[model samples]
Target: MSTETDPVRLSFRDVCARRLEWHGLARPSAGSRPADVARAMAGVHAQVISGAELGVGLRIAGATRTDVRAALWGDHSLIKTFGPRGTVHLLPSDDLPLWVAALSAVPPPREGFPEDVRMTPEQTEKVLAAIAEALQDGELTIDELNDEVIHRAGSWAGDLVMPAFQGKWARWRQAVHLAGMRGVLCFGPNRGRKITYTHPGRWSPGFEPAETLPALAHVVKSYLRAYGPATPQRFAHWLNAPARWAADLFASLAGDLQQVEVEGIAAWVVAGDTAVPAPVTPSVRLLPYFDTYAYRVGNQPPGLLYPGRARDRVLRGNFQALIVDGVVAGLWHQRRSGGRVDLTVEPLVRLDAAQRDELGVQAERVGEILEAKPRLTIGTVTVGGHA
Candidate 1:
């Protein structure tokens, strides 16, 4: 009676716990790329192991960045691997090749666009060629890069001087697409001059050859084993690929995944593992913008958290989320003044004192993770409540 649309749900707590188990049991002891390992161990975005704020929340499940890097490369080397959508992500030392093969060659942008909607190939090339040349030896800051991009495109660049660099899809997506093609810039660093696009060979010297499809198959198998009882759609969402492609990928790696009935629907569960551990007790946590918990699934299931509210908050694009007991309780934002960070939480429900306290602690950790060192304040503003 379970339909594919009605997936048997796993709580946020369960997802976090499973992430911990995978990090501890499956991650390589040494020489694994920090980014890939971060993605596989804690879902992409490196939220679980971001910065020095480890051993807290779901992130504590993973090893320290130093320990993780040392384990993978025999040296401490964690560089910004920013590519694809121009967002920085982490990469593992040993698994870069697998990620490259799986990701670098994204099928040419789904064609059939209205003509003159964006830039032509020649214009895109001119802009990207300038960028690659500019960033050939080193990185640039956001301001520097934006100016460079504007200069490169010249009169044909179009009007990109909007509120948030919008109108520049031609430059933005093209840069990311080219970076993806090169296979470096996997994830990135946001230090002083946080401009992305760099040569991987130059940035990360002495890397081992990336793994083959069999290895990628193993990694996918490991992903299911750790985060199983999940759907192909969910897997695809997490991996950022088309669901059908994910389905084919799953089918190709036979015997590694098992079909299980969840809420009466057929879903894939990790096959090798014999144990189904009870999830940790549900608790409130504040996730950052574009957290893995919010964007990791192949398809978005609003009912699990926001219900009718999903469309308003979680659009097709990424957004930060508020998680309660493994469900997205609502969305939150931060305002900074002096050394204090105002944690403004706009929840879909009324929060009790314990939940408020929990939110405060998590917010403090978030500030610390971002190196803001701000005093935490938790205040609830009631929004439209469901009857």
Candidate 2:
């Protein structure tokens, strides 16, 4: 390992390939649990639940959507909650304490609502307390929880304020994300078609947030392990934190991190983790929307991971990416009707016979994960990007 003043030098290709290996893409982990995959990837984005399942399933041999769900709602090994950037994600249940502590430490973003639409700090605190109390017994649908919150907190909690889908959301709704990060709220199993919310204690009894400083250190180290040789700007982007705050956080932990030069660009990694493996050979993968690997790589230099058309087609549009040896090589989409799934792949670079065959095999794997029959077409995908 190199010291802060003695930076280690690494190539872009080596760094990219190393990240793939760390993410379990270069070689999937056999017989791995869903939580194992979730923990390794920091957290699996669950804004699109099916996409989250695909992201976790693809990293574990013989895993499927059912397996991920079982870990989430059945075995209590995984918990769905608000994570990085205040986005919904599936994280390891055991790690909730660390995540809650680290995430709660981040300063909240400036209020974006008008004075009349915004909740006062006191109201926000009262709403958070009500959320924790309401979920203490069991799960509650959003509507049911809303009534309970308004009843317990005050009518002020029910005031329509912040803008949402097509209408304004209740003033209390603004505190939901903060409630989740504070270990007071999380997603419960769905009731037929409607989603539900519950307290973290429902699954992990007596759950409590960890100490802030140690939790933050663990989060930073875990990030570097998965996507390291990265700058504070990249870290800030990944965490959705202010650039100045991330830079100061990095400086505070300088003794535990090692300075490095990735293709002449300055970066940092865990102090003892400086080894760079040889560049990976050609490999093809179909990554679903919001896959951690796809989104995290966006912070890297465009020339390295999103060269040429990929920057516009994949990163700019936030489309499902076709990864070839650690770089975004194309776009892909899947449409399912009953037991059949039709996959459309649009490759920016012409694939040879071997690569085409591998793509076919990858398509079959996706079908197995979804329990559908797959029909793959190596042509342009006409569908637009999804949120």
Candidate 3:
């Protein structure tokens, strides 16, 4: 363990490159499975499921969207559920116990909704129980699940409280994420165009939540291993937890953490894992929106990761990123029409001929993963940000 008094110092460039290597970006992992990529990424953000598939597909050599889908619905190697920040993610099914324990322990934000819109603790618990019971037997569309929850819990559970896209959502709907973290709820195969939810126990037989402290420790170490030389504040932001709570959590894990300075910024890494590799040569990758690598850079000193115009174009807007040599160098977008994908890359930095060629190769890889013919264009991407 490293002490605050004598922390290891590292350059931002070295830290960025090390993170890329850990993410399977500096060198994509050959013959790795979808679950392997998901595990290395901690979890792939899955608000947009296709984006999640692309994120995992890009990290593993010869991997495709079909393989990712098969891993989720066929092989049962990946589980789609609420992960860090209470967002949908594709996680290794075997690690669900650890993920659930750690996520369930995070105290919900105090002032998330107005008093009228929020569910009382008792109501929340009851709704979660109802959800567990509803999903125990088989998969159910949201509508079916909602009716079952209302029937099992009470009429109060059906009262429209939380405002959604246009109208209010039922009171029980707020507990969806909570149920997922409690290890009772997860995404099931889609019923045609509609999505379904099922009990994790259905697919992960004999599944049980792990002990909280040890699981949390494992999660913290996993984060550090994947995106370390990071501060508790960044971890808190990534997890959507309170900064003070994360700081206290970091303090409790002092024996397992090493203090480090990244370009003079104080951070922590898993103990005994501080060897930085030699600087990597420039590489190009087109990451889909909500890609783990694109999102986990976590409020670093502005120019280090999001250089020049990229801060506004990529980071602030949450646009698909064009990465060059482990930094966000531009924005990219893809439009699919029939069997073809038109890729538009808006580079903030001038690309040399070699870099342009590499971008073309990366675009082709994206096409292969999606099983579409790709046309690469290096120019402005006029599309708006995705949700």
Question: TM-scores across all candidates?
Answer: 0.66, 0.96, 0.96
Tens digits of per-residue lDDT for model 3, 1-387? 458687788887778778778788877789789998888878888999999888888888888899999999998999999888878989999999999999988878876888887888898889999999999999999999999999999999999987899998898898898898889899999999999999999998899999999999988998888778788898998888999999889998978999988877788899988888775555888988887343454435556778788888777787899988878899999999999999999999998988888888899999999999999888987878875
Pairs in steric clash, model 2: none
Best by TM-score: 3
lDDT tens digits, residues 219-274, model 1? 56645654565776786666555768767777876766666554445667665443
Number of the top-ranking candidate, with lDDT as the measure: 3
Candidate 3, residue 148: Cα displacement in angstroms equals 0.3
Q: Which digits, one per residue and each the tens of the lDDT, describe model 2 over residues 83-170? A: 8888898999999999999999987887777888878888888988999999999999999999999999999888887789999888
The ten-residue window of minimal lDDT in model 2 covers 292-301
- Residue 284 shift from truth in candidate 1, angstroms: 1.8
Candidates arranged by lDDT, highest first: 3, 2, 1
**In angstroms, how far off is 241's CA in candidate 1?**
3.7
